[model samples]
Target chain A: MSGRHRLRALGALVVLNGLIPIRTQPFYVVYLLASPLSFLFFISVLSSGAFVPFGVTGGLILTMLSAGTGLQSDMTHYRQDLKFQDIVVASPVEAPTYVTGMALSELVYSTPGLGVFAVIFVVTGLANLQSIAVLVGVLLLVWAFASALAFTLATYLRDVRETFMFSPLISLGLSVLPPVYYPIDRLPHWAQTAALFSPTTYAAQLVQGSVGLYSLSFGHALLDWGALIAITAALFLVAAFKARWKEP
Target chain B: MASAVVAQDLFKVYPGSHSRTPALDGLSLTVPTGGVYGLIGRNGAGKTTFVRIAATQLALTSGSLSVLGHDVAREERKIRERIACVPQESRPLYFLTVEEVVYYYLKMRGLPSVEARRRTREGLEELSLGEYRRRLVSQLSGGLRRRAMCAMVLASDAEMLFLDEPTTGLDPIARREVWAAIRRASREQRTILLTTHYLDEAEALSQRLVLIERGRRILEGTPGELRGRVRYPYRVALQEGVAPEELEPYGRVATVEGGQTLVFAREREARELARWALERNLRVSMGPVSLEDIFLDVVGRSIDEDTPAEDAEPGHDEAKA
Candidate 1:
């Protein structure tokens, strides 16, 4: 009925995120912080000094992973386990606001990934004002695109098991199969062509370009920017227009 | 008074293991504008499905349905603005305190923070959750969690409420507490549509009632009217020493605890039964049958004495989607 309700939903979403750290402390450590950071560390030791910031990419990508996991866990928990979807669906809140509020909440919950990136860059002497600015933009863009896609997919999946079973496959595939962990330029032409479709490839390129880690052609940068905006806008539109608020 | 909700030949066909079955099979019901209306049935009788459709949380497979004169299919937002639902089996899921759960839901329902807090505290006090207002929902026991969930709806000023088995898992005393809270929440402007497995619950709260079976409305009336409609409106109970066959001349007979109970369909039969009981040197009394008896009579037996589970059969999620 009012903008305040949207604000309340957002507030509740933040509170919901805050509670997660306290409730699942072990999960926060083992899966959220440790597992991803450990992988980033593993990748850091093997790569060249110039690529130590590649660890930041791992941290950055995995931090946004909660948006996808939230799609799987929180959406399923709200719909299946707690049966609270009806409560929201029956309210005056629009589906887009609910989806955006929840995605932003997961982003808030996974903010420590920012700290992970900060620590890696500071210790590795790779921190620069311009690179940090690019990293922030990439995080927000990737989260918006990925969360939109995740929200759209959740509209079709039936249960917690299905959401869970498919979500990690999506997040891991998005993170690992793209240039998030490796350089796109060194890969085969076929792999580079495929990576063009992934936003992370461009995101990695954008960050690396900002820090002079990779050579990005001006024309190529224009295409990357277009792909990021176009894909995100399209996904957001589909999620907003087609997400099922009630059973049809 | 205007009808608060109207459903005519409503159908909700859920995908099943092999074939499709209507959860709300040709069911039609009307709930008036004020006081409490009860929908009571056994498991899989489509009470929650009916409530879901009315609340605009699920679409009907066919036929017409509306809430507060707003079409369920086309005017969901208008109906949602006026109605609230306490969904069945919704535990206290959020990590908020008991009071915050109520307060925030009120906020989500469009109330200002101050009023939300005030109504939340009022709901908390009414439901006896005030003592535990500061406690997290997960910290509460099962009954208290249910109380918190009910308070989430009670804290709102919605014109109507769809409460699906609000007292399903409560202890007797806790149940009475919930009933009292529900009574306090009702006003002339408010309509309460609730489902229950407890006959006493229906008898206590409902001004009008509908008894559904497997998604069909088998019986509908005020509790007293329903009781009067019972096939065996008069009941005879004799000591355990008496046999059921001895009362066959009167009416239907069945074994009840500590007695052989006889049911009579008419006053003449009841009079004859009482006279026979007296003449045979038997200790017996004839009384008007209760709503529970009518429920048993309608359904051929009572099966709700067991715990109330909201149709948890496999592959039943399609309707709630």
Candidate 2:
């Protein structure tokens, strides 16, 4: 498929996958909504009301991160179980097109949770219209970055269990280990270095910075924005092109 | 006119396979357009690997392949636009209704919206999947799902089709239904490359057939030509219980079922064998051996004694059983 037609397919798949969770497995919706809220509540109760914004950040990060890196399970089943990849591979649709559509589908699946969180943000007086727009932009970066990494992982790990077995650990590592709940200043030097590479850290920084929860300089925020976009673009290229579409 | 698909010296060695043997070893063939071409092989015979490569679902280790005059390596996109496949292991998306599955696939193939809808309706009706058009595919039975796959392919505007073992798991009725669907698919004289282990299926649908073992074409011909490949032109099958050794005195014998022995021979020899069986108070039936007999003969052993196994086992179904 051409770039334009692929975009069309992506749009259609996003809309189609929106209802997949409802018709096929409604439990996933409850799980996605509930699991993130439980963690957000824990963060809030542990700290003072000062950490409530951190709680919201924690919830948003987990919701998007789980859907993103959890691609290991979704894409693998689509390839090996349902054989959707084999179907699309033979069609005019390009591999990149298929990958992008899948990424969007995951994002689409997470939308309801994102919507619930958005309501929480508005009710708590945590986000204004501008912060919401920035939150959307930053989450897109995280979605692309994590999904691309997961998509690239899928090309080699043919087995679903082997690839997805790391999901809980990945989601935990991306959501908790990063400074999504605590401030980066509190992390030790080595972990601070590690958080630099985690896509979730930049996402939290963007969302936290958007709500004026963290004091930031213009230069650093500008750098974070560039890092978010550039790193996501690079990773997406790696996932879309580095995949071994054909056996050598 | 040029052939629909052509390959020269194709080789596919799967990475890290237990055995060192390549899946496809120097396989080559030409499938002309305008009719169904059957490829028959034993399991692991490279029938699927060959079709997969031709269909652009795989990369060949070494070879030249072209479909509809487009080189497989460089023109895969162009080739993909012209072909559709019902892959052996592929399943329809359970999330979509049967009609939606067909319609979406056709749209993905770049069919115009109206054309996609019209053909989706036509395909569902043609395959009798119309009854379940609005139902999710996951709710359909296996037989109906297979028809849904075929309907999606038939709904497309593709001029070439790759059908790999389309009827492997269907019941007799379902198999016949699938066969009818395939017949309709080939009605417009579209080029169809079919891989099937069922001799009856091949003979019933293919205008021409090729038998490959170990990824190389060995015996190929029209069904009649393949049937005649055996030196014997007729078979004398005992109608009642008789020792196969008893028929050995008349001609070479093979067992078809419990108490039924087939004696392969020329017309006169079969007549003589029938008479000998009758004299022994055993009833016998005589008729032309079928393509199944020819396929079994070729797969089990070389057609000519001088020809070495030349290749590893294709893992023909009976051999595996």
TM-score of each: 0.92, 0.91
Chain A TM-score per model, please list them: 0.89, 0.90
DockQ of each: 0.54, 0.42
- Writing each residue's lDDT as its tens digit, candidate 2 over B1-321 gives 889988899887665443356778788888988789999877667787787788787777898999999999999988987888888767887788998888878766666678879999998888777889999888988877878887888777789988888877677887887788778778897888998888789999998999887778877878888877877768788878776666676666755677677777788888888888778888778888877667555566422222223333222211111
- Candidate 2's residue-wise lDDT over A1-248, tens digit each? 66656766676556455555467777665566777888777777888566888888768878887777656677776666666666777777777676777777777668788888888888889888868888888877777788888877776665677665777778777888898876788899998999998777877887888788887677888888987888888887887677756533
Best candidate per lDDT, number? 2
In DockQ terms, which candidate is top?
Answer: 1
Model 2 lDDT at residue A219: 88
What lDDT score is found at residue A159 in candidate 2?
66
User: In lDDT terms, how accurate is model 1?
Assistant: 0.75
Tens digits of per-residue lDDT for model 1 on B1-321?
Answer: 779999999977654423245677799999988889999887767788888889998778899987999999999888888888888877766577888788767766667778888898888998888899988877788888998888888778888988999997789999998888778666545899999888889889988999988778989989878877777888777764566576677777654664455555567888887887788887787888877778777777674643134432223365434
State in Å the error of residue B72, model 2: 1.7
Q: Worst lDDT window (10 residues) for model 1 chain B?
A: B306-315
